[model samples]
Target: MNITALKPFKITWAVLLCTFFSALAHAQENLYIPLETQHNALVLSVSNSHDLNIAYYGKRLNSDKEYSSVLRQYNQTGDYSQVLDAAYTSAGSRNLMEPAISVIHADGNTSLSLKYISHKVEDLDENISQASIKLEDTAYGFNVSLYYKLYKKEDVIEQWSELSHNEKGPVELTKFASGNLYFRDAQYYLTQYHGDWAHEMNPETSLLTHGIKTIDSKLGTRANLFQPSVFMVAMDQPATEDEGTVLFGAMEWSGNFKIDLELDYRDNLRLIAGMNNYASSYKLEKGEIFETPKFLHLLSHNGKGEASRKLHSWAKDYKLLDGNGERLTLLNNWEATYFDFEEKKLFELLKDTKELGVDLFLLDDGWFGNKYPRNNDDAGLGDWQANKRKLPNGVSSLVKEAGENGVKFGIWIEPEMVNPESELYHEHPEWVIKQPKRKEHYFRNQLVLDLSNPKVQDFVFNVVNDLFLENPELAYIKWDCNAVIYNAYSSHLDKQSHLYIDYVKGLYNVLERIRKKYPKVPMMLCSGGGGRVDYAALEYFTEFWPSDNTDPLERIFMQWEYSYFYPAISVANHVTEWGKQPLKFRVDVAMMGKLGFDIVVGELEQKDLQFVQHAVKTYDDIKQIVWQGDLYRLSDPKNTDFASLMYVNEEKDQAVVFNYLVNNRYGQGSKRPVKLGGLDPEKRYRIQEINLYPGTSSYIDSNQVYSGDFLMKIGFNPKVGKGKESVLLKVEAVR
Candidate 1:
């Protein structure tokens, strides 16, 4: 019998049946998948022969409408030979552009191709839905799953990727991105934030021409050189606040991250964002899985203002820890006393805290260390014990005293750093991150602890665990990381390339345990000011210190840019003694976020003290509106001499406006009309000026009523003075 010939005939019949079923399934099911929010949708199409592509990502389209035509339109343009607009691009094959995922297989093969396998959509809640698409390499024993979590109400989507391999040998992953997006526009304007230690969150806007623009950080610990977020405005005109199409993306990562914006030859803008592949190439062994950080993006046709509002809503609703909890007004004694305070000074501060109506009293940096006292920043960082010489009675006594005075107590600790002179460092010299036989580098007189070690992770976790264990009433914690990782070598890690990635994972593991142990405690994420301000870290923190530079003028610019993505509830704005601006101006600026005072409140004169008390009361009254409301940027500080912004509650019943005169100009007009937004036009609102000096008259009528339509259209023109003069207005809807 000629069985070989019969075997070929059987194989042909099997192939024919498989092709017939695939065609039948394609004809019966929709090829385009739409992940929709309230008003936006990200439609993905798997109609192509071997690729998954984004068909449309903008305003919501009717589900009954077919998107195959749109996919065909996109496919008709660009280079026909290459996969121009893919949902997730890979290296090799027909893709010549920057790949989202690049890998080297066991046989040193670099060529790879990913094809769609299947997908599923599930509702997480009434406001969030997740859609996951599975793709497999055509030739390799690997699979990649892409995820998009749609925040229905906020109109924001969170995207991430997971890679798993079942290959016999290890696979070297060179480039892996959390999310990839494509936009076809004539012009693209990119707005990103970049700054140094004290001058963080400085925003810059530039036109993206023909090449690639990358924003990244190689700092292993505090990735604050350039924040991993951007706003891309697509229009024929320049970027505007409330009138153009805007795409916003922010990476939820605390360690090294990179955001690449490339304008291809066909004027298509491609954005690839995820953990940085700078010096951290990861390896995946058989049966191992690697997941990228969450990348959040939103599409808005109403302009940057709407984009900012949606992101802020999403952050407060889901991303922030204890998103709806109260952020108490605090008085931190860092700038007031520095590392030179004793127990008596703290007692005095506690008295002032009660007198000034502050909710929490935070003792910053000088209270710890036993064998090596933390008298300064250069010593006793790793030792978490209270300094016996300074405290004499221990931190528990202080916590008790503060509680007796009707004020909560908090303390600061930089757990991820160690001083060479400390007992902990001397005992375990291998815990510090350093290359073998290399001279260790120091920043701010400290070295970063090698968190890649499990023992070190346990120690870091204990730094917080022991504090609450000793003083169960500890109301808050300020976790600070003072230095960036340098000489990035981990003694516990086998491969040097895994140092950065593993360090972040270890940090997160410790944080996760701490959060689980102390879930209700309010903790602030601080790193030499605004160094570690990212979404991933904020998930474990209640708030963040925006910057060490608390000068009101500098904070005006800093907080403005920060409000574009982060909510006001997460901003810890402090009124410090760093600027010559008036006390009222300083307090008003701080009141725009989470209000705090870092100055010597006991030294305030009678008049200033009264004003401080008045401002605190005013902030207490409107804090709910400020923290939980929708923010609208009325004026940009970059274009004008004054900055104005407002927050309106969800009910549209109450609102608060903050106006600051940044710089004075010669012969400038004394009064300017500021247009308001985010209001019900039919309702009548009663406006009153608060936080004014005793017996001082406002620029307008203190208590007046106006229709929302008039307020939005005609606006209110307030009488202004020189620079540093500010105004705070409270508006209430008339019942």
Candidate 2:
């Protein structure tokens, strides 16, 4: 928590300093609670009953009147709705306004009062600032503390709430949101990402109507595709790719969670987000405290791109992904040899793998326990041992050989599942999650292990730990979980257990053990594909496999939206046969993220193979800028015939642009200049072509100098040839 990294450094709000200082000087008053960053401010005032109400929460506060209290000034008299509103609008109570908390005491009562206990400035670091408000209901022996921190440098407010009890008995909570937020107006466009399985993290936006729009996940495993934990609300109309006022929020929990935006009768917006109430009610004993997952909130007058930058900056600064990363170029054996592997075949693939300049080799599924034999999806899961029949030489031998050949080794594992045919499952039938007296359900011919139990957690951890200890050369692990919770009941927990949250906790605990032991090894999270990519899982894994669908055209849309909240280096992109090479579109798409190859290189023709080598060389040349630079989404794939993306370094000294036309268009010979952003306006840049594959045309003349302003504002048109085509260009600032 280096508070300094959270706040922005620019000084646009300096003119309002006098008024802000005057208002802040009086913020010590019992009736006023204010938190301000360099440009944004949140003001709240205590009501007569001691509950805090929202005054303002947007751009910098220039006057006390800007956040004038409505509840404190208005004198309510007649109407029942208005009367009810005046009487029951507290954040900790269950009435008109949404309650941030709802806890049940020993007597089974859910109502409690949260009186203002105290407020203080937690940190005043020049880069970041934080404030805290503590509330307590001594009568019920319950207390809550809300924390707010602003990264003045990034324009982001990270917030969450903690609940604890002092009574001599256990207390249960039904609903505990991070915090309840109030907006002054109801007019907003709610933007959300909703998809299932292969189609994950798809962005969509709609106007907020007069009802509760909720995005939630009840599935035990982050509900990867069903309901994501991030959202944005823009005023008036939805923001374009690069413009408008928007408020964004994302809960950083990889478990069942909820996010709701309610427009009450009063035409104001009420937002509450945190752990989902779906099949979750955590019990807290006396002297124990529970913390809700953090929710990142950001306000941007400059549209989704800027708001997203704030998120990316915070995530990177916090090391949310433990990302010490320049993601490697590798080759995964899944598409090349799924459930099919031998020492010779692996060695044969290694030849092309080395020739293509891939530094890492990932052995996909099929090297495991003999009982199930990994013959297909039906067997060989719960067992972590190498299949003696498939690889008689052993995993250590493979690792040693790969290392000897100048390639690092990684393995794919689905540690959270068990096939009924597995030896472990046969020995411990009680380990699988199933109902007490009902038919067991299965997906991919497998059942989920009851991770909530310590025994199961230990079992999973030991399997991976043994592998790493035995083969010190193991460089990475692709951890995959491929099923949903069709039957989520845990055989190990009590009847009232919160299976959803507990399950994720158990999974996290297992991951923590492995991370502690193998701190340097990078892990990629996958669930079938892109299922568990979020900040929660990011804590343990360095990146994720964004999709099993490697169709580059579709990825133009998926990866485009995916980059909105994540860095390119955190996505595992593979070049499969489809979008096949040279056209080389597949490899070009894969190069946009953590590049890898999924198809067998041996099957390629000589010319295409040569093209593959050239493509890899080109990728290596531009990967630094592609993975580490700020991404500017030029044109969305879905809206038009072409999709364009640009990556620029922070100093704006260099950049790389990617352009693709999914389908060939007719009747047009005109060139269209692609304007780029985030450039040093006065500097001149030498633009050069970076394309290596055939069927592509050079977008710009090589070694041509142009002012950054001219390049960004009146840009160079792409030299796109006929038929589905793409081109890559590199720009370096020059004298």
Candidate 3:
């Protein structure tokens, strides 16, 4: 029991800073509390001298060093903190109706995880001599700002509030070298940047690119708020220039590329969204005010795109296809290529993905606008040509009719929104991103393209390299973004430089000038969906689209939190059997990763397209052991026993287990007995049963069994398969 002797009772925050500024002189008239702690959670910094800087922390979802350093599981008989405190006390008919858990702690060495509980603050203002607290459970949030500066300075917030609604606009800013911040709303954009904008060597390849970019010349005062929202508080960045100031509360993690919402008092917004780690809860409401929405991926701008399962044809011999290497699995057509797709619905979805073997054929977004006819997200975002009334033989006759159906065609672009009734913003009204006098502010109505003026990056690089010089085969290019950047300013910099780190180095110089002119077109990085899967956009787009809520019992905790820091070969996993169960639990949770198929296979029902052709042939036979193996994390996701386990080996004689029992309680014993791990003791092992949740029968074995005689005679019930059940395992030592 040495793991910090079962931690949780460590409240040693004796800062008494004059009794926390004498209880903030009875705080209320525009407050400032600022408690703090990092490493074991506890933060609360509320400052609303007016411009808002709300901060509340302490969110749990399994603590105790994440149950002894990541699910080695310790103990907690399970029941989701009494079913999430009875679903927030049955949300007492909605909105702050007096829930409970004002605070709770977990301590150490692991086990006793209701995941997270305690983070509800709502102080509107006044009463502060000073304050700061520090409790523990780790992960924290809340920081609403209007102003603070005892002098930390990132560029003295020149006009903020991206969107807290009721009209407070100034939208126009872009910067990013790390001094992060952004603003733009006509073509949709809002900012705080930090979804893999790395630069250890020009990192950002595109996951809706952002790390900072806020520019403002003057578009001031405009906030009807629609798709624009950001409150993201936590601040610190001061270091020197005297270094002796106070006012603090910081906790930064950012990886699941931005998504955090709770609001529900006629404000209706629920999406918690995250791929892995990050999202315990931060819910801020009080006098509730949020506004930031100016065209953030509501589709249109030729729609928007990103979908991938793998598209197997060896994906162009493994570079993942496009430009003659030949390793694809493609078949996209975003929701079946929306409203009208002649050419025989793209040859009946590329002839059943070339007889279930697939090769390539994407066509998301609407295919450009012609006065907008069902172009989604409101209007006709900056038309990029090619919709002479929906393909009247253009786009090179649909890439020479999808290369005569042998497949290999792609298209979808956002080019950073611009449709305030576009014609390129009516002939470049100084390329948008306003703020000289103030007035121009529109979110799903569009306007945000000032790539730091190199003539608006050569007019969006000659309308996206003239659509690859008129369809030179097209290949693949998704590249989309939705929005963020709460009124930043930029009219070619200087007014004291820093346009949110030069709009994140002008979005890595527009993806390094489109990889020096499409060095073989292959981009993907979409936002709005998967919010921008990160890792500095995987050094320039190879894959990512990890979430749009894939739902396979909720993608087993979103692919176990995107495999704790990406690399299931960059992920693209599709197989979306349109929610609410079945389709083999959405192709066994999209065959774990890197696969693809978003439906429409001759309109399913041939036994759900033969269970998606055996879940894409068991995702092409264990996709090289789930892309180069080695993961091990087994069970305990704040477990109320929706049981879970994970394995994928390669060394110690190849393993491949993946148990999950979910929804237990019938005699509370669905048959236990599971230990098994690393093999090859005295050799002799064959066993080849792939999936056995509820048992279908396919067991074989050489059976030598060593390693503590198979960890005391292997057994596995696991639970949570409420949709019947499943247990998939596969071994193969053989020495």
Candidate 4:
């Protein structure tokens, strides 16, 4: 991947760090990288001992006056030997004493001197500006390039680094952080999300005391619980959805990741993010290059929603593939057939697809490899071939048959793992990640593929990438990683300690290759579920299967949390067999993103099938707005009895709202007025209430015209119904 092509953000100089290099000493030479945009300005500079500090970040400023006062009067600022805290920070050899970069020079020099070298500013596509500084310590024969980007439209600054060694010798990289930021405020608090597979993103907020608060994930596949492992540092006062200053950001990395926020004694705060130094170190040969994942930081004056909007917009610009028109409707055979998959039964599933408007048929986990028949999860991974028993006519035949029936074909594959009993695992026993003299553990009866090995990376890339060139009809793929990598050592890696770092890079390489090879096919990422969904993976994959739990109420929470960082189009929300629940609620909940189904359509009653058919058509009609519109998450499902979400397009001419309530209180038929959000407010709208429940009155008039101002104020009132129920409302601005 060419680093220059990555247009993260455009920058302006709020606190310009004089870009020219003067060959000053590492400790005395202060290098500042300034990125000033209309919404905000971010200035990162190197203080003493090559410590990169976020000198200023927040409101966009016009004055170039350097805020040197933020360095403090009593502190050494950039003077390494003068400040006592410098002993525990920058240029330190001890753990918890994080340095910008730790290198071992061939000259046997004890001190790693990163003296200032040079600087450059370049413009990228989309009006993005990039300012970079080159810092090389010839004593160690190593060079490090720090890059900062500012996007013209958003209040976000992106930071990343590239590390390489000179021709003189080799260097061992024990520790590397993409960037370290400093904020002088002691009152700032840290916020992060923590959860399991189904409960993927739960917000955890706490004040920062005089200590280090780290959110680290070693699960190996971005860890469903702590993704991007992204963290936010905000003032002690809580920021509301639309108000308050909050600095939110993340590292776009997939594998083991870590972010550390330290509050030193001088009342100054520091934040660092990079490859998790979890039993990992890299050896950079002469000319070998290692690029740290991009770290995106955004400060919102209008609050968390603004930050979310900024990140969502940028993610769309970089990752989101344009929705190929209306959102697609796909059918996965997992819930429908489990492992009892056979050609005859698969045809039965596809038979209902076209009639119900599901254009894509996904053959889930059972139709791969002969040695380890995928009847269960214990085997068959890493063997990427058609299972004759499951598809006697071959998988291609099934794809052809599906195409004949008017639906495209998709398949599920776990290429990043191997079953102990599978051929790939037995043939390449050294390919699995395992620590020295330690017991090996497994998740889902599988071990993670050691992508750190160049051969392993090539093999996995060829096997899966071949699946496409070999079968041109395969329109989409659900790439899944079902194992949590516990073993921190890869036998093929020369430096056993470099497993975590090298493995992630190798994974990215494979993904990058496959994406380049098959540029048109869409891919979705799932680790168990929601485990590997982050910006890094987003660069290759189009959608994220956030959870295995398809319950409508559960998704309302899961989707809401992830939408804070990702755009709605990237979330793969499905209407599965959510047991006895109203189809109304299921489809309504599924309306927020790319929708799919997990039910046995062949078994549904005619009425239910007709409902599915109707739901599919309804989705196709309004999906353009739903997938591309700005989302306003309203009401909480965890606390309130009701949950609601609103979607409005860029033109503000169209809108859709999903309002759900479970087990009506006393059957009071209480009418709760829901004023729509994100409308033009001044324009008049013609509202249409689409009622899903057959018997109960939708309570909404068939047709009513009202001004956007009136609708947002007085709102539409729907009579609450008995049992679990949901409603959908569509509004269109009129002349």
Candidate 2 — what's its lDDT?
Answer: 0.76
Sort the candidates on lDDT, descending order.
1, 2, 4, 3
lDDT of 2 at 193: 89
Candidate 1 error regions (>4 Å): 1-30, 72-78, 227-230, 233-236, 667-670
**Candidate 3 lDDT by residue in tens digits, 166-268:** 1122211111011111111112121222222111111011112222222111111111012111222211221111121111111111121223333232221
Off by over 4 Å in 3: 1-330, 333-345, 348-382, 387-390, 393-411, 417-426, 432-448, 451-489, 492-498, 501-531, 534-561, 565-571, 574-590, 593-612, 616-688, 691-735
Alpha-carbon error at 651 in model 4, in Å?
0.5
lDDT of 1 by residue, 1-735 (tens): 989879989997787666555543543353778889999878887754757876677778675375545543442233543356788999977898888999999888887788999999999988889999999996887899999999898888989999988888999999899999887667888877888878888777788888788888898877875464544555544557788887888888888888888888878888889999989888999888899999888888888889888888888878899878898788999888889988888899999999999899999998988788999888889998888888998999899999999999998989999998799999998898987888988999899998999999999999999988999999999989878888888888888898889999999999999989888799999988888878889999989988888899899999998888889999999988889888888899999889999989878988889999888998999999999999999878888878889999999999999888876777343356888988899999988877887657676675688899998998876545563278888988999
Misplaced by over 4 Å in model 4 are 1-33, 45-53, 66-89, 93-97, 107-110, 113-115, 138-141, 165-169, 225-228, 321-327, 435-439, 662-675, 694-696, 712-724
Candidate 4, 201-273: lDDT as tens digits:
7777788888787777877764645554666677646776677778887877887777878776656676777
Model 2 vs. true fold: TM: 0.91
Instruction: Report the candidate with higher TM-score, 1 versus 3.
Output: 1
Order the candidates by TM-score, highest first — what do you get? 1, 2, 4, 3
At residue 106, candidate 4 shows an lDDT of: 59
Colliding residue pairs in candidate 1 = none
Q: Would you give me the overall lDDT of model 1? A: 0.85
Q: Give Cα distance to truth, residue 327, candidate 2, Å.
A: 1.7
Better of 1 and 2 by TM-score: 1
As a whole number from 0 to 100, the lDDT of residue 141 in candidate 4 is 60
Query: Who is ahead in lDDT, 1 or 2?
Result: 1
